[model samples]
Target: MTAGETLRGLLELTRPVNVIAASVLTGIGAFVAGGVTSHPVEVVAAVVATGLAVGAGNAINDYFDREIDRINQPQRAIPRGAVSPRGALLFSAALFAGAIGFALVLPRLALAIAGINLLALVAYTELFKGLPGLGNALVAYLVGSTFLFGAAAVGEIGPAAVLFLLAGVATLTREIIKDVEDLEGDREEGLRTLPIAIGERPALWVATALLVAAVLASPLPYVLEEFGAIYLAAVLPANAIMLYAAYESFSDPTAGQSRLKYGMFLAAVAFVLGRAVEVVGAA
Candidate 1:
């Protein structure tokens, strides 16, 4: 392969956007969970560890989903023959090791979160993707747990639980929408996702209900006085995004559900802004 193709393939396997999101989520978690570290070095270490672990999960997920990707995503690194399966596995292992190694030096809390989350990452890619409700639930927890994991890295974050629940509900809602969109692809692999288990309309309804739950819960931080008025600056828009996501899910637009990915990111941004304001207001 050409050098450019090789480089692109490697990056594709890691899903850099997702990795960056994980790190960003970690930072938000760390900051809200405690106050981002007093030491910038520790903050860097935490983000690096979270990013590596996220990369490890993505690489291995591609390796395992190679056959599936060959049908659904023919241009992926493995499907395009840009990277060998064994090579991908090795990359995943190296990334996982680096993540854990980096966390080991940070703090005991980081170490524990790293190890448990790594295991969950492996299980998610390997075992859970094929299951139905359980898999969807796992993905939600895994995604939302990044918040808690980030919080744990710094110190005991009192408000982290509410954040976890809010994110988790939104994630589950998003995953269900994706399942409805991927009905044919998943059927080809004989995977029993929510849409396959029930029906598309029912699944969409479930997703819409969950989205409503998220919308209702989004105001909790402000209601509880965790964040200041500045948080509303970002969160209000994010809530609007979630509201649109609910409508989209209900309408079942032909396009697959990728829009909410950014919407979730926006919500995280709100949290970060709100948390910063909270700290500043307190100080």
Candidate 2:
């Protein structure tokens, strides 16, 4: 392959959009904790570290899942021969190193979270991916931990606790749906994912139930006085979209998971807006 193609493949392996979204989530966590202004450097560090870690995780996952992707996603970088397995591994390692470097400069709590997350990312594909719900839960925790990591960076994790739970549960729901979408390849590979352990319909039902619970509890941030009316208003629509997405998953898992991601992004935006309103009101 040409140099440009190889570069593109390497970048694709990192899943840049996910990296950016995770970084934004970390930034929101710091903002919600009221540390963005007081702890600007730490917040930046946390955000960058989160992005790097997510990129690293994605790359490593692609490397480990190369075989699976050949069946489920022939267009993927590794499967398409855009990037070699060894190259992906080395690139992921470099990203992990960068994440660790940034994380080491943060507080003890943040450092601890980062350390655990990095280890989990490394172990996830090989050690946990075959388990039924355990893999999904681990991925959910990793996603949710970005918020806690940011809050910890500023020495206050309480404010972001609700966000962590909300995001984590929502992510878990999506992960399950994704498993259903990947059922064919997972079955062929003998991977015992949630959908494989149970029936596809049952797995989707579990996902639906989880999404319902998360939607119902989404208003807690406002009710608990952590956010303003704007948060409630914004989150209402986000919750609706997520619920609709969950309903759609039973018919078309691909569309459902994609829409669910959009809803999650909207919810994240609502979080930033709510925090902004509170900050403005205080000012």
Highest-TM-score candidate: 2
RMSD of each: 2.7, 2.5
- Name the regions of candidate 1 deviating beyond 4 angstroms: 1-8, 37-39, 232-237, 254-259
Every candidate's lDDT: 0.79, 0.90
Instruction: TM-score each candidate.
Output: 0.86, 0.88
- Clashing pairs for model 1 are none
lDDT of 1 at 111: 74
Give the worst 10-residue stretch by lDDT in candidate 2: 157-166
Residue 30: error of model 1 in Å?
1.6
lDDT of 2 by residue, 1-283 (tens): 8889999999999899999988988988898788999999999999999999999999999999899789889999999988999999999999999999999889999999999999999999999978999999999999888888889999987548877877898899999999999999879878899999989999989988987887888888788888888989988998898999999999999999999988988887888888888889889
Q: Which candidate number would show the highest lDDT if scored against the true structure? A: 2
